[model samples]
Target: MTETIAPTPNTLPARSIAPWLKFTLELGPLLLFFFANSRPKLFAPLVHPFLPAKLLEGESAGLFTATAVLMVAVLVALIVSYAITRRLPIMPLVTAILVVIFGGLTFYFQDPSFIKMKPTILYACFGLALLGGLVFNKPLLPVVLDNTMSLTETGWRILTLRWGVCFLFLAVLNEVIWRTMSTDHWVLFKFPGTMILIFIFTFSQVPLIMKHELRGDAAAKAPEHL
Candidate 1:
């Protein structure tokens, strides 16, 4: 009798949430972050009941308030996601961990610098992780992306490389923006700016994805031997 091998996490099909819901979960917190920072007075009352009184005062008040809101919103999003899917997606889970840690530090130290550095650290870690996977002969972009599309190994390699580079570039860009620009400007760039860039980059890769995409007959036959 032949033994059957179990599928690994990478090979398992993703339990995907609705596209709209996923978008809301991801972008909602960001928009709230911007809103809270821009209008801290609005969120202050809501969050004041939970956070330290000292963290919500003075010039950094808006930023600190936004950080608190962001931390809570991210946790809520994760909880909603897990409740719906019964499993947390890896990328969001990692992001939430970083948000809580960095946001906590920003609140505790009463400094906005930590929150400003979160994006740089998050993107850098993602970029390095993808590159590291390539070095180990493992294409990890699909894993991070939840294997939404099927592609040839070569395609995965190329796509992974592109995303890895893009992530690193975004990391550098975040550092530049936060270090040189005002907090408000940085928030603006972090939201619509980063979203626009990612959308453009993603659309630009459509041709590459189509070129290497596994299709009807090929897809059906590719795994027959297995």
Candidate 2:
């Protein structure tokens, strides 16, 4: 007779978002950013009512406009996520903090590089945190993911390593792109391109997760009830 484990839950603890809400919350800010950066003049009037006149003018208008809008949008997203879930997802919170800091610096210095480098810094931090946790015999993915995934310790370790390496790779990639590519191109890559890559990478691990899923005592005990 063959034995089988019950399918593990894909939903993360305190991190579940309804598909529609998740799409809106995650993509809304990025879309706004792209539009603001690409068509600053068009967005300027809409945002100008809220922004200082100093930020609405000069050669830095596009970048500044986008950065300001991005910051506000992220804050709103975080609030909405918390309102809906009653908990904040760690990665997005971390990303939001970086956006605020770098976004503020970008405005203060009037240099777009600070905002451009936000992703590189964010990815590097995540990569380092994941890898560092493993070195101490702790897998941080479950914590970061807040998911109800049931994996063996070994499975968790492997997934952590995979994600750690992927994040570092993304960090390097962001650096390369922002340094060599145009601002508009980088903005596109930052939001849409990076989001697609992450979605693909996440789904790619489903097979591995299923293979190593651990059946809890409750699952084993359930057979007695039958």
Winning model by lDDT: 1
Candidate 2 yields a Cα-based lDDT of 0.85
lDDT tens string, model 1, 1-226? Answer: 9998887865564366899999999999999999999999999889998878877887778889999899999999999998777678888999899999999888777789999999999999999988999999887888787667778888888999999999999999999999998888999999889999999999999999999999988766543210
Model 1 whole-model lDDT (C-alpha atoms): 0.88
Per-candidate count of clashing residue pairs (backbone under 3 Å): 0, 2
Query: How many clashes does the backbone of model 2 have?
Result: 2
Against the true structure, what is each candidate's TM-score?
Answer: 0.89, 0.83
lDDT of 2 by residue, 180-223 (tens): 98887898898789989999999999999988786777334321
- List the global CA lDDT of all models: 0.88, 0.85
- Native RMSD of candidate 1 (Å): 4.2
* Model 1 vs. true fold: TM: 0.89
